[model samples]
Target: MVEEAARRDLAAIAITDHDVVGGIAEAQQAGQRFGVEVVPGIELTAEWDGRLAHILGYFIDPAHPELVVGLERAREQMAAHVRDVLDAARALGVEIDEAALARYRGRYVSGATLVLGMLEQGILRGSPHARQLLLRASREPRPFSAAEAIALIHAAGGVASLAHPVKLRRSEPLLPARTFAPLVAAGLDGIEAWQIVQGPTVRDHYRRVAEALGLVATGGSDCHGPRSVGMRLGTQRVPAAVLSAMKQCWRDRRRALPDRTGSPR
Candidate 1:
């Protein structure tokens, strides 16, 4: 990934691994070796109106104890959700070998992985079937509310942003625009105004709303990994100014605290 980023002329990148910070140190090391800036980040799942919402935390402290604790809790929840899905699959007459699934332990397991596991075992035919089966399961571990998630991100010395507001609406009934105001009131620092998959018009619409609301407009490629999801590194570069502003936001947040020391509590 570092090599690819360098090849593509990306000056910096954020490793916003889902629900975990364990990879940040290695990513930072690679960034150093490859001459690229690595923004420490995490994509946290929060609940709003009983639906799942993704919150992106930029410039976060990887070693923050509170954030660590929160991640552990989230991991447990994810594990439970995975277990439930496996169980549901079994009830549907799809056999699963426990040993095969054991390999994913000690790491954050994605729903996609679980679905793929079933497909590999010939339990499901394709992505569509896997998705439908998982949706039928309807067993998700409760997540932090949006307010709590924003508070946690702030506590971790990170700027909180609503991730892919447009995509988020498709999964749930609540419109992103409708929820933006309440989220801002709850301390949201920004919105993902630009996304690689979104066209210029969609990005512009989000940018306009963010500007109107006085919220920071952030963007990313939303790439999972090198060559994954057809995402080309550096194709959708985040502006240097946006990165500067986010860093400044982190600094200002730190300065606002009564304690001069920024150590994890």
Candidate 2:
């Protein structure tokens, strides 16, 4: 993965393990070894209406108690979920086994890793299946969701941003201004205003929403490990002011809470 980033000439890279922060150290080490700035991050799967929502945490401080507690819990639950999926698949005669599970576990280190692998390999189509089959349930071991991801993001001394909301085709439900109004009112900090997949119309809509919501506009490659989804790593740009506002908010929340629990109501 680090080699791929180098090939792209990226100045910085973020390691966002889904619903967990287990890879921060390795990512930092790789960044140092490769001379790319490493941003410690987690891509959390959050419980939403018995479904799932993804919230990305970037530049997060690792040792914060609340964030650490939830991430640890998430990792355990996800491991269990994977086990359950293997079990189910075995019962249904899918030809999957414990050895297969072990082989895949290391590769499927995060939520994005698991889902992206499935997508690339043509196992699942999108979020709904990723939720109902893997995240919400599975054949052997399934994935699991953490507590409110936005809260975890705030607690970790990081920025909280929606990742690929529009991809769901239910953006109006998942990220509608009305739905986000209260979150913004409660300190929702940013949105991925410019994304790799957004067409011009979607870009314009999200941009207007960002301005109206007083949220920082950011963009990302949503790069999963070394793989490319027609989006080159680090090619997307997030304005410095937007980045500053998110960092400032994180710092302020860290100060106010002091106990490592940034409780967003």
Candidate 3:
């Protein structure tokens, strides 16, 4: 990711892997080598108002004990959920490779990764089949609530932001003020006002919402990987000022609290 950022001439990029911070250290080192800044970040899954919401934590302490413990718990739950998904697939006569699945045991196993693995191993048919399995698996409960996610981010000395609010509900319309109110009250520091998936109008709408609520407006490409189609590095071109604002918010939070032995709580 750092190499790609440098190749794209990006000043900086955040490594917000879902439920994991293991790669941040290496990415940061690569950032130094490549002359690009790497923000230590994590994308956490949380439940809010009976739906799943993704929260992005920026400038986090990757080694924070509390954050590590919480993420470990979440990973365990996700592993169990993957097993349940495999069981469901077997019940439907889909053959799965137990050995291949075992390789993901101690690592972060996202639903998409699992599904794609199955598809690659010929355990699942195609995209439509994978989509069905994902839909079924998504019904499983998340381990953390939105408030807990925000608190965890804060404890890790990071600013919590809502990621791509427009995609939070596919069947429903964009999140209203009432929806964002609870999250903001729970210590959400920003909203993803720009993303590759959202057009200019949608981005403007989220920017307006962020401003109205006094939340920082952030943006990202939401890139999954270098090879991911249609999602490329530096696609959104978020201004440096956005990152500056987030840094200010982080500094303000640290000042409001008492200092600790290590990084501010």
Candidate 4:
């Protein structure tokens, strides 16, 4: 990921892996080596209206006590969820090597990885049965509420942004935008106005909402790796001003707080 971003001449990039901070340190080291600024980030799952909404925290202090505590809690919940999925797959006659998965003891097991593994083993091929089982298994433990997630990000001296609000699966048009008010009040600092797979119309809608709500507009490719379909690094060039604005917001928030031990800058 580091090499690809550097090759694309991106000024900076964030490593926002799910429920883990373990990869940030290594990415930071590689960024320094490659002359690319690395923003420590994490993608947190929060629940809103019975849906799992994603929040992206940028410029976070990876070692902040609050952040660490929250991540540990999330990790435990995710591990349980993954175990449940594995069990469900087994019940459905899908063979998953529990011993092999156990090797990633303290790391996150993303649903994509799990499903891809099954696909690689030729045991699953986008079948409705497999999809249904995995979907049911993955939602066992609900995540932190939106307010809680925003507070966690703020506690870590980072700016919290609504990640891919369009992907929230809300049926009502502008439901996400309507919910943004409470999120902003809860300390959301930005909105993802651009994304790799979002069409132009959707992107414009988000951008308009961000502008109207006085929120920072951010963009990202959300590229997982070289093999990520339709996700190309550097395709979404987030404005430099977005970073500046987020940094300023973080600083102001830190100054208003009683503690600054985890200030990212």
- Which has the greatest TM-score? 3
TM-score against truth, every candidate: 0.86, 0.73, 0.89, 0.87
Q: What does the lDDT read for residue 255 in candidate 3?
A: 80
Q: Encode model 3's per-residue lDDT on 19-77: one tens digit a residue.
A: 88988999999999999988899999899888889999998998999999999999888
The Cα local distance difference test for each model comes to: 0.76, 0.61, 0.83, 0.77
Task: List residue ranges in candidate 3 displaced over 4 A.
Answer: 98-107, 126-134, 171-173, 260-265
For residues 129-242, write the lDDT of model 1, one tens digit per residue.
Answer: 566675644445546888888998988888899888877667642244655888999999888876886668778888877787778889898887642456566777778898
Ranking by lDDT: 3, 4, 1, 2
lDDT of 4 at 111: 56
Task: Tell me the lDDT of candidate 1.
Answer: 0.76
Q: Name model 2 segments beyond 4 Å from true.
A: 49-51, 102-147, 171-176, 227-232, 235-245, 248-265
Indicate the TM-score of model 3: 0.89
| The 10-residue segment with the lowest total lDDT in model 1 | 101-110
lDDT of 2: 0.61
Question: Which of candidates 2 and 3 is the stronger one according to TM-score?
Answer: 3
Q: Which has the higher lDDT value, candidate number 1 or candidate number 4?
A: 4
Best by lDDT: 3
